[model samples]
Target: FPSAEHGLSADTEEQLRMRGCELIQAAGILLRLPQVAMATGQILFQRFYYCKSFVRHCAEMVAMACVHLASKIEEEPRRVRDVLNVFYHLKHSKGKRTQVPMPLDASYISAKAQVIKTERRVLKELGFCVHVKHPHKIIVMYLQVLECEKNTKLVQTAWNYMNDSLRTDVFLRFSAETVACACIYLSARTLQIPLPDQPPWFLLFGASEEDLREICGRILRLYSLPNVSLPSMLKEVDQCHLALDARIAKAKLAGGGLLAVGTPTLDVPSSFSPASKAGETGAHHSPIGNTLCNKNSVHVSFQKKVWKKHCSLLCFIWTPFWVSALRLTSLSVFRRSRSVSSPLRSVSPTHRQKISRRDREREKERERRRERERERGRGRRDEYSRRR
Candidate 1:
């Protein structure tokens, strides 16, 4: 009966993902699997949660299965039992002192069963698309292509960035090429390595500067470096979600005419008017009586004045951006529809007439210019013939 509302909070979910990434790395190290396997497993674990909630599934079991599945997919298979044993050792040895030791009774069977079950679930959630494209190969290819492979420090830093990026959701959101470009960009910036400016590097991968900038921002935000606080960012994200929910609720209420006649009585302050007190004290107090009272009238007028002033200020602040956004969106939609449909159907008759008139005038002007040029060329030919 667990719902999303009762599930993990934003901060907790991020922490759990970080833990899962750590486990994937540890398991990879313990099994002697290549870094690619670890990266693939981390991506699988992250992608699985997009389809299934973390509240319903255990993170540890899923992480182990991901690593196990990744090894098989990478053609470096590890036994399910061996993977579980590695997890068991990691938990018991590194777990906090206050943490209760995992029960030995039926633990092996349960752990192994959970790993297999979760592995199947992960595969199903991923739609059997086990092939994860990691940025490591792309990083190497980019370094070689850019002729920067000789800079061991830069290459190693970029490799570390790619590894760190897997801990975040960038792998799920962006392409391997983009992530590779972003990592390399960040690494170069960190090392003060000057890259070519005329034709930026990201363009080679068909990625724009903005795309690389966004990916790098996400990666930097994930690292929560000295200037960036993860908790504060999470708080801001939660606030934005809450604001969006509030806007939706307000729109629903407005559309339903539930708040059309009057403002909420509960929201009006009782101290502002005696009528509000009458409504509270007298059982037979009429709803209209509150609005009829002179004191109440004055209070309502003042509230309305203040509300209008605030609305005007807000409109002044946001009008330009809102107008521009709407204009751009409408223009794009109109262009798309015009391309798909007949020109006659897309534009009104009046506008079409205006456009046709402009086109005709342009055509006439072009014809006149072409005639003038031809006449001048003939006169020049005649003069040259005379001179000859």
Candidate 2:
């Protein structure tokens, strides 16, 4: 195990952190809960790298696994089945037996599995560096540096703003010290958080003045804009977020509401139903509560038959509910949801009786309205004839 004395050089550490952060941010944004899961994955990543030496390929797998692992650690965990499922789905494979692309074939899975199996080896090599210093803690320290009195409304707003910045790449590239300074700087200037003297090293982080200006500018843009829909330029970033959520939700449903990532099934309660999001009402769910798919894989079987509607090009389309929710909470759902609608047989006993009843009531209401309109039209016509 490497000690603090034997740790990697600061430059090397920055590169590793940057790499790890990229994977985590990408996965989290794709999965939804970008800030929360990214923070969780970052802690795991720093600890993992702090111990064992870096092997280029193994490091990538460990980073992916760290994110896969951290998602479960946070309340929003993705299923292993979903992870493997997407790996297959992207290739248009029907099952796990299908061959993957040349480079990321079974060999890749084997390599990743090896890393996962011996993750404890890497952990042991790191001298058990589980505890991590987070940006939230640093924000508290900087608040004291600025002699901010308490977690008042102003203090809370600044803290929340700093948390938002962490979602972007800037926090990963810059040190906590530099980030703390910039955050305080930006917060004081934009949010009007009072600061007497600017910290000296605010201008001396590894990032160039141009980069820092851009980072701060994005943060400022976020603050100034009145929560408007982002323009088309940000679609890829938005799509990544949606894809991640669909991957997780599909896995959970397949796994019966628990996602197993190299471990036993952990219970994740069902929140949003895919059917409801697809505008399918009165469809019976699987016998299991939110357990819609295979626990080990993404193959799902529902209780009732569902008509298959394939919009291949629109497979990644987000439901309006998903769009609105993600707009508010920033959760993404990339897959087109599956919903079952009532059968078309108007009088078939096999069809839902309630549905037929509702349709009849609607038809009667429409007929009444049509009759009233015809009466009004006749009266107008008669008045015109009399005037003539």
Candidate 3:
């Protein structure tokens, strides 16, 4: 998975994947979505994690979004509200078997928005190729070809195995046809029903014995493992994420020279990396959360290419329309936001001089008025002395 490529451990990533798949399966049952939808949802969850990291996304939220997207892809759509309600109870039922569902409040609204946004992210990552070819029907077809369709026990066993295998990464690694053949092989072995060893039946179906054994081994491992608790898995993922964030924050602090080389100041952007700005050296980079493809690529501030790319993006971000609409009233505020860089310069020099002159005149008038008041006080004091 892409997460493993980053920093997530193998065991943690595997658990999170399995837990997400289990959540999808359970939510599908509660929402009355088809098995194909559940399987598709699980596959999508795997594919997404392959692109994103576990530290970057909440596994539970992504799982819910995958199920939501999968339902729509399968044309068995469930509304966001229904999906939310089902998951709310499913998550809340940790202590109580009959946990009450959460009401449609601000929290639900926020969660609803997250699910929608996450769905977009999933679709974006998958490039809209949401088509999932399930091996459930393939297993049936291959069994029929083998004339074992009459054996309900064998058929059901293989079918269950196919579903269980979805919780693993076998779908992403192996083809649907191979998975189907492998399921048949395992089912026959479990029932002690001998198939043709002369030619090794799976080979006829394009699945080698090595592939079948690998898939079967993965499926069997799932049985040996304990059931993953969704809430606990989420907690573990959150902890890992928090640790990662802290590490990244530390790296950023270390790299940016904040409190490392000097005290932090307002001109952090310009002075953040003085060495790079002076063309002395490349800016230090944090290795914690860099780009997925390239981790060691620190932003070279002295490089014109990097600055130009960022400037281009900023140019699109803050057009005149946005800058005019912003509540940047003070000159200091304008100076602070690069979006409205040097608004002070926009005023003509003559206009600035006129404003400075007007301020000087106001100060002189105040001084003259104060002198007159002092004179009147002296006159009163002199008259009192004369009377005395």
What is the number of residue pairs that collide in model 3? 0
For candidate 2, give the lDDT of residue 39.
79
lDDT of 2 at 107: 72
What are the models' TM-scores? 0.55, 0.34, 0.66
Please state the error at residue 46 of candidate 1 in Å: 0.6
List clashing residue pairs in candidate 3.
Answer: none
Would you give me the overall lDDT of model 3? 0.83
> For each predicted model, how many residue pairs clash, with residues at least 3 apart or on different chains?
0, 13, 0
The number of the candidate with the highest TM-score is 3
TM-score of 3: 0.66
How close to the true structure is residue 27 of candidate 3, measured as C-alpha lDDT? 96
Q: Residue 309 error for model 1, in Å? A: 84
**lDDT tens digits, residue span 256-279, model 2:** 644322234566446666756533
Could you tell me the lDDT of residue 257 within candidate 2?
Answer: 45
lDDT string, candidate 3, 334-365, tens digits: 55553335556535566567779999999999
